[model samples]
Target: MNFLVYAGVKLFTLLLLMLAGGLFLKALDRLIFPEVDFAHELREDNEAVAKVVAAAILAWAIALALVLG
Candidate 1:
């Protein structure tokens, strides 16, 4: 039960971090490349951004599991 609680908390935290990171990256891209079309880039290839967010969440989950376990 304690492990479960810790995992849940860590998962939630990781998700929030992923979301914030995604938004921040998007904003940064827009600010850096105002002339470039972000929406088109995202539509053309979402895998890049998805991979980043997924990796962050996965890393956090693994770290939390190792520390909590």
Candidate 2:
């Protein structure tokens, strides 16, 4: 049906947008904290770094939802 096709397209678009936003955040993270290695911290079981990463992801998702809604 036409509705199914439309829904699929919208889902794809949303996925693309999320990918772009994540890449932007990765770049921004490196720019802001040049010395802090997020991957390394995460591998070493750093809770504080994990929390910060989660917070950043949640903030981005909320902002994206607000914009798309």
Q: What's each prediction's TM-score?
A: 0.58, 0.85
Off by over 4 Å in 1: 42-69
Q: Estimate, for each residue in 1-69, the C-alpha lDDT of model 1 and write its tens digit.
A: 999998799788767866776687679768977886656755778777567556766876686567555
Model 1 vs truth, CA RMSD: 4.9
The models' CA-based lDDT, in order, is: 0.71, 0.89
lDDT of candidate 2 over 1-69, digit per residue (tens): 999998898788789989999899889879999899999999999999999999988998898788767
TM-score of 2: 0.85
Local error of candidate 1 at residue 23 (angstroms): 1.1
Name the candidate that leads on lDDT. Answer: 2
Clashing pairs in 1: none
